[model samples]
Target: MAKEKLNYIHIIVTVYVLQLGVDMFRMSNMLAEDFGTNGWIAILIVSIFVVGIIYTIGLVYRLGEGKSIFEILENHLPKFMLYPFYLGVAVLWTLIGTFIGKHYIFVLQMLSFPTTSQSIFNGMLIFLAIILFSMGIYNMVKAATIFFFFTVWTIFVVAFYLPEFEFIRLTTHFFSGGDGYIKGFYRVFVTFFGFELVLLLFPYMQKNTPVFKATLIGHLLLTSAYVIASIVCFGVFSLYQLKYLLVPGLELLSYIELPFVERVESLIFNLFIGEVIVSIGFYFWGAQEMLIRLFRKHSKAKKAKKLTLALIAGIFVYSMQFDTLIQVHEMLHKLSLFHTAVIFGLPIVLLSLLFWEKRKEKKSNAKSI
Candidate 1:
C-alpha cells in the first residue's frame, strides 16, 4: 500500500521547524565568539556544504522507490549490518532532542523564571512531544506550518535594529585566523545540522512532490534568515560585546521600544516557544520511527509508538539533572565528532553503497533480458 505522503509545503515546514529551534536561539552568539569578524564567512562555507548534503539526501530518498529507507534497507541488506546504522541514527537524534529540551528549559530559567524547577518544564515538554508524535506525521507537519506564520514576523523585527547597526563593526579582519575559523565552523555546523532530517523523512513526502526542490528552497530560506540575523548581530555589537552574550538575537530584540510593550524580547521569546516545540517534536518523531524499525520491524505500530514515547520521555527526564547551560554547550562541543561520523559521514557512505547496488542490479537485469 502507498503510505500517506506530505506535499512540498509540509516538507518545507518540516525542514524549517527542524532547523529553527536551538540553532536560531543561540547560534549567532556562538559564531561571533568563534570567528569574530569572520563569522559570516564561516556560516557561508558551512551552508554550502550543508546544501550539498541535503541535495544528496534527496537523491537517496528516490532510491527508496516508495518505501521508507528502513524498509528498503531491511529488504536488501543483512539485519546485523543495517541495524547498527539504524540504532546510531536513533541514538543521535534522541541525544540531540534531549539536549535541545534541556538547553531551552535552562534558557527559560535564566531569562524569566529563576525560581521554577527545570525538571518540571523538561517533563512537560517531553510529555508534549510524545502526544504530538502519537498524532502522526501529517498533524505534526500541519502544526509546523501553522506555527511558522506566528513566528515569521520576528524576522522583520531584525529590521528595526538596522538603524542602530554600525557597518564599521563588520570591518574587522576577514580571516580571524584559520584555527579560529575552523572552530567557528564546527559550532555553526551544529546549527545547520538538522537539515539531514530529510533522509529519514523522504518516504513521508508525497511521491509526486519535488523533494529536492522543496528542500533546497526551504534551506535557502532558512540560510538567508540566519545569515541576515547573524550579520545584523555582528553589525550591532562589537567583537568584545558579542563574545560575552548568550543570545545576541534576543539582545537585538531588547532594543525595540513599542508604544504598548515594555520588553519586545520577552514577547518574542514566548512566540518562539511554538518553534521550539515543533523542532523538538520532529526529533522525537524521528527517534520513535527509528525505534519501530529496530524493535518491531515496522509491525505492531501502535505498541511500538507507545513504548518509544515512554522510553524517550524517561531518558529525557533522567538526563536533565544538574545540567547547567555551560555544561550543555561543552557536552555538545565534545559530541561533535560523534555527530559528524554518525549523522554526516554514515549517510554519505550509505548513499554510495545504495547507488552502487542499484546500478549493479540494473546491469544484472539487463543481462537477464
Candidate 2:
C-alpha cells in the first residue's frame, strides 16, 4: 500500500504545534523587558511581519508547483555549487535542533531532576526524535496531531489568572520598558521561527490541500497564545517583576492551587514534553533530509537512518559541555540570529530564483519563436 499524504488539518496542526516550542516559557518575559506596559503590542507588531513571511512562503509554494525547497534549488543549480550551501544549512539546522532539545533538557533538569545527570534525559529526547523522524513525515504529523491536544490546554490556562489579573497593573505606557527595542523585537519574533519549516512540506501535501489557509490559521493561533500570555502576565505582575522573571508563563502556572493538588506546574510542564519532542523531531528531520539531499543518498533508507543516528549522537556529545543554563541561553541567543536569517532569507532567495528562472525561460521561448 502507498503511504498517506498530509491533509489540510495535519499541516495546520503541525504548524501550530511546531511553531510553539520552549519559547513560550519566556516570551511574555521578553515582551515585558523590551516593551513595558502593554508589551503584548510588540507581539502583534511582529505578527504582521510573520503574516508576510507566511504569505511569501505561500508564493514559493505556488511558484514551485508542489516541490520541496531542496528539489527546487537542486533543479536549477549544480550539485557541486549547491551541495556546499546545503551542507552548511544542514549543519546549522542540526546544531539548532540539537541544542533546542538540549535547552529543554536543561530546564527540565532544574524543574524535576535537580540531581540526575542530564545525559539520560538528553539521550532519551534525541532518541525519541530519531524514532519519530524514522517514521517519516506522514507518521510524525499524525503523532504531533495527537500531542497537539496534549499541550493546547496550556494556552487556555491563562483564564485561571483572571481573578488576580488587575488592569491597573497594566500601565498606560505604550512601549515603556526596554533593554533595546530591536533585541526585544527579535526575541518575540523568534517564537514564530519554526513555521518557516513548512516550506519543506509542500511535496508531502496532496493536490487539493489548502496549505496557506492552514498555515495562516496555525500562525494566528500561536500568535494569540503568545499575545494572551503576554496580556495575562502584564495584568498579573508589575513591570519590574515581569522584567526580572525568567519565564512568567511557567511562574504563572506554578501559582495555580487546587484542593486535590498543589504545585501542579511540574505536572503541566510534563505535558509540554510532548510539544518539545514534536518540535525537535521536525527540526531533526529537516536536518536529516537536508543531509540526505546533499549526499545524494535519498534512496538508501538504512544510510539515511544511520545519518540521523550519527546526527543525534553528535548533538548529545556536543551538549555535554553545558553545565549551566546560562551557557545554553547564551549559545541559543547567538543561534537565533542565524536561524532568523534563514527563516526570512531562504524564502526570498527561493522566490527570486524562481522568478529569475521563469524570466530566463520566457526569453528562450521568445528566441525559439
Candidate 3:
C-alpha cells in the first residue's frame, strides 16, 4: 500500500511538521546572524518563494494524474538515466534523514543526559522511523497529525515572553546586523527544506484533494510560527545576545515557569522529539519509495522490509562518523545546499518534462488532423 490514499488534512499537517523540524529552536539565532536586526524578513521572502515551488508540486501532480515521480519519470526517461536519479535521491534523502536525526539526538543528549550514549537515542529513533516508513503514507500522515498537535502548542508559549518583549530590540535599522546573506539565508531557507517531500506525496493524495491549497495553508502556518518565534526572540534578546545564543526559542521556553512543570524547557523541548521523528520518517519514506520503484517489485513484503532495515542501518552507520556537533553543522551546510537544489530543481525538471510532452502531443495531433 505504498499509494495509500490520504486527504488534504493529512497533507496539510504533514507539510507543516515536515518543514518545521529541529530548526525552529535555533531559528532566531540563525536569523540574527543571517539577516541581522531584521533578518527575520527572510522568512517572508523564502515563504513566498517556497509557496511558488509548492504550487508547481501540485501542478506536477495534476499533470501527471497523481502518479508517483518514479512512475512518471520512468515512463518518460530511460532506465540508465532513471535508476541513477532514483538512487541518487534515495541516497540523498536517506543521508538527510540520518543527519537530521543525529543532530537532534546530539542536542537532546546535551540538554538532559550528558552521560547517556548518543547511539542509544539515535538508534531508537531510526528504528521508530523504520516502523513509520513501513506503515506507509496514510499512517505516517495520521502520526504526523498527532505530532502536529503535540508540538504546536509550544508556539503559543511565546506569550510568556510578551511582557519582556521590547520593540527597541527589534530596532529601527532595516537589516543592519547580518554578517552575510549566503550563510544566513542558507540557514533560514533550510528551515523550510523538508516541504519538498510533497513531490513524493502525490501518489498518496486522492483525486480533487486540493493539495495545492492545503500546502499553502500548511506552509503559511509554518511561516507564522517562524515569524512569531523570531519576533519574540528579537524582542526578548538584544542583537548582541542573539548572536551568542544557540537556541533562542528554548531560551524563551526557559523563562516560562509553569505552575505544574519544573523544567519548562525540558518538557517542551522533549516534545520536539515527536516533530523530529515525523521529519525523519518522511524523508525515509521518500527514499524508500524511490528504491522500491526502481527495482520494479510487485510484492513489497520481503523487499520493503529489507529496504527498511538497510536504511536504518545506513542511518546509524553514517551518523556515527560525525563525532562532534561542529561536524554535524558542517554537513548540514552542505545538505542545505543540496536540499535547495532538490526542492527548486525538482519542480523545474518536472514542469519541463510535462511541457515537452504536451508540445509533442500537440504536434502529433496536428499531423493526425
Whole-model lDDT values for every prediction: 0.75, 0.83, 0.82
Task: Give the C-alpha miss distance for residue 2 in model 3, angstroms.
Answer: 15
Give the Å error, residue 202, model 3: 1.4
For 1-369, candidate 1 gives per-residue lDDT tens digits of 966778888778777777776567566677777766757777788888888777777777666464567766675679788778766666777777777777778887777889998888877877777677678878988888888888877788887877888889888588562337667777777786667767777667677677778887788787888888888888888777777788887777888999999988878887777777777778878877877776675568677677666768666766766468888777666656777776667557667768877899999999999
Question: How many clashes in each candidate?
Answer: 0, 1, 2
Worst 10 residues of 3 by lDDT: 293-302
Between candidates 1 and 3, the one scoring higher on TM-score is 3
Clashes of 2: 1
TM-score to true structure, per model: 0.92, 0.95, 0.95
lDDT of 3 at 333: 83
Candidate 1: residue pairs that collide: none
Judged by lDDT against the true structure, how good is candidate 3? 0.82
* Displacement of the residue 44 alpha carbon in candidate 3, Å: 0.7
Model 3, residue pairs in steric clash: 35-39, 36-178
